[model samples]
Target: MRSALMLGSATLCAAISPAAFADDVLDNPFFKDSSTQVMARNFYLNRDFHNNGPNTQSYREEWAQGFIATFTSGFTPGTLGLGIDAIGLYGMKLDSSSDRIGTGLLPSSGRHTPGVDKAEDDYSRVAAAVKLKLSKTVLKYGEMTLNLPVYSTGDSRLLPETTEGFYLSSNEIDNLRIDVAHLTSLSTYAQSGHNAGGMTRADVYGATYNFTPALTGALYASDVEDLWKKKYAGLSWVKPIDDTQAFSADFRFYNQKSTGAERGGDIDSNSFSFKTAYSYGAHKLTLAYQAITGKGGYVFYTDGGNTNYLANYVQYAEFTREDERSWQARYDFNFAGLGVPGLNVFARYLRGDNITLANGSTGQTEWERDLEAAYTVQSGPLKDLTFRVRQATYRNSFSGDLDDVRFITQYPINL
Candidate 1:
């Protein structure tokens, strides 16, 4: 959410960390740089709906535990170095019942009932990718996680989503990067199979340039077979105002057009947002303005795990509708600046209006408020362990209202 383009982000199918090797494999270039890691996650979610549709559940609550194991091998020593990466994910349901389900932490479907067809007790999946590196460029085939603006796989749950196909990343040019991918399949965390969301072919391309030491720009585009075509451009600038203060500004633009079969209905929209932030000492303030104009809202691949890099993409609402406009104000405090090394707190509020309904009505509005605090163990047997709590409330003039809270704990182990 901070930047329109998430460059250099790790492809974690729940991923992370250094190349800790075994004694025997230290001599080989491939094994010397190979490493393994496992992340243990505990998640609890509770969402209360104040206004619900008829015959629908009022709330959803669930607790679950997850383990993500990842392994990466260094490239072999040659002109075209070859390597492989693998990931294993497992999730176990800890608490849930007929009345409380649909937490997204565990795979579930069908009506809200305590039956075999509802929620499973445990689920596990594994995938691997093969890679070849030539100079400063790498090409990968098979399953992997993506974090591009045009096709970012979601990692907001107990596990991360993944895609299958050919991907290329090139940093051959100075301060510039080129990314190209042909995605053929997708796997969501809330589903069991690798292609649980169905198989669709998509072509995505992106380029990023670092204009200066403190300025960067990016452009990305995608074509989703029969759904739509999207293009995005972004600029980010940051300046330092002494040793303890800084300022930053970010701008993002997106254009979409329905193509082929037009599975998303008639769509022609342009969306843009600008956000600015100032940080002095331990306090930081950010304000953003965003608007969408067209016949319909901004259209993107939700099922393929694509992300909206707009500033107003909040916790419960996107604030993106026909002719809709939204603004956000946020404050953040790092406890480290206040003599607490591993603590942080954040609060933000957003309000959106000028919405145009399908029936041609306008002026409806919506708002979302969010608060979160996080703590990490700085020094202890469980060093680097993190615990976080988040709360959000959303209200709309023409839709359901919700109060949502989440508790999360994570521990990473290297082996």
Candidate 2:
């Protein structure tokens, strides 16, 4: 029965594609009304640390390969057009050891690996969605990625994080976009299966307004049942100081409180961050400051997945601390104007002080320094292939000392 259903869905998708692209065919019977495209990506990552602590690993390394396939069909004929989309994700481990088991780069089950007993093996997931479009608004349901500022879906690891939910978005108003979503279930990187009975119900709402070509503002609220409720707002502005120079500024504020089962007790926090950047030709410099107030500092939500990529402000880096103050300085350069079209480099330093840990320790300080370089193929058969190397060193009065190096190569193809 399941096989039959899957086959029927695939057949329907094929039948709808031609009709979806009919409008684009200029009196050509062979022209289809719909369009379909697929994107495939492979990512490799390696991490090694110099020292280990009770809470940290001394040396860890991993290499993972992943493949993602997506297919989309255009809406059928009608005022309320409907379409179907499917996505398939698979990941395989290339290297790792028991000492690096919790790196979140692969899926591990209990004490045994799925395909390999001693060695971690492979995992895969398949998801499908139904989409509807009415005027300038679109509604999507099923497995998807959440990308709101307050509740962003992470994509930091082998596979992008996904949620079982429904999302509605509208761009009916010029320069403004509105988004709202509800998530009911989740699956994490540590597990290959879905949990429909978990404590993972959330409601998210937000709107972004582009006041001008160079200025924008956003506001959002999220109610995460059994976890936390948060309200976030931010604004960003950019202006050209001169023909060859530009300046940008950003501000963000978050207010959060615990809720439901996860809230053993009432806890509240308020956090704010501000950043300014200046660019001259191929070089850019940025400075940022952040502060935390209230009893709690910040709240975090994770699906326990390998995909840890989140908002820039939420990253711990070297300056993240509870009720602590921090600052960062960064520099970046593009080598395109220097004749290396697809090369870029960046370095940043962050420092924080006055940390409050689990123990009643204050006046604790920490810092981090990070460097990264990346390049991509601009043309030829391997065009769009990218390579990156990142190195970071962290030292904290409470968290201990750590150093890490990572290298990744990505090949992205769109069909």
Candidate 3:
């Protein structure tokens, strides 16, 4: 979607509905129910490498400020409604230097390439989408953010990744929803262009069904042109034992195989993960086990939006490798029960083993530990302001050792 097209369409609508002829479309539900929001985010990232060498930078650190604004217009009144959505992103460097630059908070001079050692001072990007609705189905074309099990966009950085394509969603079935999309290009969080790895076409389809209010299932598949085909299946169930106690189980599986000329190489892997959680009044405990088997490790478009949904894909490590296995244990607590509302904390640990190194070395292992605390303002002009801090320690002979820390602050404004 283009802003110029949106403006032209508005003018056309106004001209067609001369006040004497009919009500102005601009005054109709379309513009009346529209909404706009902006988010201000301050982020600082520091990762200290345990071992740094000639080819590797000792540590990557960056501080940045970002603003994300979104505008969503309500559909016009008609059998086939029309609407538009737009997103604007701006990032400014607060503190960054050539020696400490690969932190993802700012674009690297080489576009996220390590050891390039230069970061842009500031960047801005904008995108929009035009949408149509008929009955319970909606179709949109232009830039968008997607989150399906098979193909998802990453948002763990200064700006979210976006895709240029056509997306469709149908909710004709009572308890089911269907989504399909055909995308041609992608823009990474650190890049402003949509030319990612010569992406010719990526088609995806997904369906979700809610058997009951407490149980749901989903199936999704995606095929990246000349790369690979991936399929995902998931199930979730929750049981409430009492007013403040509950148990939940989640299962996820992925099967991937190379196709066409296999531009991404001959990948043949099956990954599965299972997670269970128990929640009490103000405490929650979670455990998960994930494994990968077949020819190689899990593969994704690293430069575009490669956020693997596997359970072991943590802040610093993805415990995914040929014939690898990993498990996690986590605990969370809410301070509200102790008279401190809007505060929470969590700690997690994950370990992986049964992996082969680059030289075919066997019995390799890796582990990571993470702790985080977050709080949101409860009242006053600072209401809804949030602050979060995370610390992590990762160790792996194959990937080296590191201590990572992140501090983030965010505030949202509605207009």
Candidate 4:
């Protein structure tokens, strides 16, 4: 990892051509005018255990404040345009203690060791990226956040994960998009302190196409050093029955195999999921099914935090264990349909069974239920002020029962 980081840093220095600074500094569009935005978020989380005794932490709770600022420059005025992007992230612990930790809102004092109880007060980081654009194609290098099918940084917490790498994207052809990248390292949102060389390395290639206004498809492949090679393909489609109703369908599949000296041991796995939804006016309903079959669970790069792309990736569990099968039913309502323009409600339930663990136990079962309600200020002085509440419950054959809740508020301003 250290060697890879060094090579990445050296490559970035050599990629920026001297032509970028040829134009007059004041006249270049990249520097003359730029756009900026700032976002402030307040978050609180609580989780209570029903069976884990007092010897362990009986409950987990925390409160934190987060701020994110971003700046993006316009391109230079020439056949070859040059630009830059910058990001600043900060997280402050508003309320926490040694006895009540493990919420991931603040970093722990010790590393990954278990049964430790200490949290940091705050953390902050700054990053910048250089970009070049020419004839509908763009190249970028340095630190940035990515949210693709194979690799997505977690942003549900206080701060988002950012990676150091080089990226290439092209949209020169109609209805087609191409992307490729080499990611060396990343700092996760859960890090206690910043370190650029602690993450695994990977190479990714992907393509997407739009067959029609109602249908889209994608294919992507990635290789993680000392880990596994992964391939993913998916499709989504929507049809309008009338002005007041619509139907949509989504399907996704993943295939993985051990690579490079069998890093995670011999691995062969396949996972697939499907979801269908129907909407009428402000009401929506959905149904989904997902399953995994192989000698081991579905594989992903775990050194840096990663999120699954499956439809069954719910609030508590992904239901991607070896030989597991799961299904979901969900409902959502928009209060605007009933005259309240800023309120909404959602609920979902999921169940999984047939989990095969290394211990040779089979037929294990688990289930979870989630509910949420939210509102935003639609007009007046606090136009964009938002508030949300979430509650979830989980029960499994081995881990006991759990309940959790979260409260969140966000405000943003453009500068």
Q: Cα lDDT of model 2 overall? A: 0.72
Cα lDDT tens digits, model 3, 1-415, are 6999999999998877686355565568788889999999999999999765557777889999999999999899999999999999899999988889888788877545555558998988899999999999999999978788877888778887888899999999999999999989888766767754466788999999999999999999998888888999999999999999999999999898988988877789999999999999999999999999887777775324554777888888889887889999999999999999999999999999999654778788999999999999999998999999999999986766999999999999988
Please give the lDDT score at residue 343 for candidate 2: 99
Task: Please report the TM-score between candidate 4 and the true structure.
Answer: 0.89
Q: Which stretches of candidate 4 lie over 4 Å from their true place?
A: 1-28, 31-33, 53-55, 112-116, 192-198, 261-266, 301-306
Q: Rank the candidates by TM-score, best first.
A: 1, 3, 4, 2
Better of 1 and 2 by lDDT: 1
C-alpha lDDT values of all predictions: 0.87, 0.72, 0.87, 0.83
* Each prediction's RMSD to truth: 11.3, 7.9, 7.1, 10.6
Task: Tell how far residue 274 is off in model 2, in angstroms.
Answer: 0.5
Over 1-415, each residue of candidate 1 has an lDDT whose tens digit, in order, gives 5352343354432244334334345777788899999999999998999877876778788899999999999999989999999999999999887677787788876753533345678898899999999999999999988888878888878888889999999999999999999999889876669777654888999999999999999999998877788899999999999999999999999998888888877789999999999999889999999999997888654535557899988767788889999999999999997789889999999999999998888999999999999999998789989999999999989878999999999999989
Error of 3 at 103 (Å): 1.1
- TM-score, prediction 3: 0.91
Select the stronger candidate by TM-score from 1 and 2.
Answer: 1
Task: For model 4, give the RMSD to the true fold.
Answer: 10.6
lDDT of 4 by residue, 241-347 (tens): 99989999999998888777766666789999999999999999999999999978785535345647888887767898889999999999999989999999999
